[model samples]
Target: MNDPRSPAQDPDSGSGLADWTAGAADWIARADRIAAISRPATEILLARLDPQPGQRILDVASGAGDPAFSIAERVGSAGSVLATDGVAEMVTALEGRARERGLTNVQAQVVSAESLAFTPGRFDGASCRFGAMFFDDAARTFGAMATAVRSGGRLAALVWSCDDRNPYFTVVTAALDAVGADPVEVARTVFELDDPEEVLAACRGGGWVDARVEAVGFPWRLPDTRPETLIDTQSELSRKLRKRMEGLSADQIERARGIVAERVGQLEAAIQDGDDLIMPAECLALSGRAP
Candidate 1:
């Protein structure tokens, strides 16, 4: 997937390592929120992968180890899982989780999808959950992923579909607009590389065979959400949006928060006990076999 914007113009252009590392580290602290956003989708991905014992699997951009650790459980002691991220912090968090779960078959490492430091044809299968979309050189990343897996091995990834297809993100967009923040830039970053053609192009570029795309949808609920957490999450979104929507005012930020809070309130009421907020999300699950 070639970038419409040149590397010189993109944060991922020359060196996205530092920024990506820091971002993942900071975000790892919000493990619960991360899980809320991705767990259901991850479950669907694992079910699709249908990992078997005695097979080796690699999880690229394993973020906090949700997909990686889950894979480990399925493979059991006979199978092994290498869960890697480009950020050390993410690997650390993943390691911690693996320890907690006594998952000896799972190991975490710091590695990138574009330049994985593994021997060729070492893995039986590889998977990435909402990870490959951030690559500066997506084609190179896919090629490397292809090289890592043995012939006939599987390549699977879970990525967000277009913005309109996802209400969780649309709600965020609405809040940002209410706050008078320019959201085009952040929105672009969020969905720019998510097009189906680009994804298939990358996979084909990497020499993957039988590439197929699946659409998965499920309800994601945030239970026990605190007002403070809601405000904080909105603020975080506002900050990210600020990178694209310049000149965001405090008043606008407050307004955005109020609107999002109201939406959450309605969702909470729908929970029957005013304890949770649920929204629907759609994702693309792309898979292929390495040649």
Candidate 2:
């Protein structure tokens, strides 16, 4: 029996959800830039969802309005898409993006995954990308999502398969190590939990019935090979990390720079005579029905 309570209230929580809420606010101000980097993968996931007209969809942790706005297009004027996140900044950005797109079908709200205010069986379907893993209790968090959908409604979320499968973090970490930064000493705050069994168990614990997990593999391309890219990569984590790193010694900083430079050179070599620097990213797409 999972308690349906807001996970955000837990201060000592080990889950990175709290930090993500704050960090995402900062990220949304630069939403267009972030959206460009992740747009391809978002398109792939939405294509699979194929939301239909008249369907009421929920875009949980809808950062920067990409997924929600995308859903709005599919649902059209009759249907609606509720875009939500625990961070107010994200909600503000989402609303701004919706307004800019002239999308009246989308609404933004500040909501947490561990607890949702919507009535049970309220939604036709729901989807989240790279969001569920941040919960303090993944099982409790997903259980809430399950309760929000109608009996026949669908739920889907995307998470990393494992650390090694994604170069965005692994390559950058390797770069930090190349310049003499201790691997173990590096900020583990941006923790990525990708165990298939753990994820499945969480979904089941959340009252999801007949949940299915699919692997989505695609190339993640970064346009630039500069030190700025390294900073952007770190931004993908959290500001807490950025703040912590800001205190590092000049020599240590230089080492980190060298590591990133080496990784960039490798990526440049891997580029296939084109502007796109595609690197592989493996995602686990989990879908299930509400009981």
Candidate 3:
């Protein structure tokens, strides 16, 4: 998992605290959209975790609260979910969302995955959605998660499978490349653990038993949206993309948008239904039980 990009250029380098903190506002603004796009993966993780009613759960790196909120509903008022993120701003946003939804069972905290401060065996289950890949040390984070969950407690995580299987990433990278943008360096980190074995190893190293990996494929659908909207949302959500875009001229930005639109139209897995767009996405779900 050695990042090829220099620390100065890597958005995910170190703890990625700064990058995530800075992007909190944007993520909060697009929370609903992000949740919609990642709903399938969330569902898969939730199923794997199999959280039971009256059981406490831990959700790590819960940036606008996805499965956290969903888990709260599943656990009901009698149970609870501790949703955490390294960035305080993200926790604030998560708290606001929880309050807005009247999810009294959900609690938001600024806690990093690598340094979870919860007592040992405090939770019945733990889940991390699209967060394992960004962890500075996946095994360490998993180890912390293991410590938080009771023995035999379930643990599940979702991560991008590969660049090839996920057109949502490739299309954007292709468009950026077509416009002479250096997206390759920034985007490659997304698939650092593309191999299922890598996830299994991390789980085992962190004291998780019966670790297993599964490939989950689903359509990332956006109803009443166009390719341009997707590109715009990506630019705003991706810190590196936004920084790169800052240097581009107005004409170059427009060109990149057009390229993205064209590429989206040509994707084999992309389906156009009325004004809606569906792009194929694949992720690896790693599951195990605390030892």
* Maximum-TM-score candidate: 3
Give the least accurate 10-residue stretch of model 3, judged by summed lDDT.
Answer: 1-10
C-alpha lDDT of residue 166 in model 3: 89
TM agreement with the true structure for every prediction: 0.80, 0.82, 0.89
Candidate 2 local lDDT, residue 186? 22
Please tell me which model should have the higher TM-score, number 1 or number 3: 3
For model 3, how does the per-residue alpha-carbon lDDT over 131-238 read when each residue is reduced to its tens digit? 888777889899999998999999989999988898777776677777787542332277888889888898899999989999989888876768876677677656
Q: Worst lDDT window (10 residues) for model 2?
A: 182-191
* Candidate 2 lDDT by residue in tens digits, 85-169: 7766677778888999999999878877666657888888888888776666778878777777889788877787786667666
Predicted structure 3, TM vs. truth = 0.89
Q: Which candidate achieves the best lDDT against the true structure?
A: 3
Residue 116, candidate 2: how far off, in angstroms?
A: 1.4
Instruction: Please give the distance, in angstroms, between residue 178's alpha carbon in candidate 1 and its true position after superposition.
Output: 3.3
Model 3 / residue 196 / CA error / Å: 1.2
Model 3, stretches more than 4 Å misplaced? 1-14, 182-188, 227-229
Query: Which regions in candidate 1 have their CA more than 4 angstroms from the true location?
Result: 1-16, 182-188, 225-254, 261-274
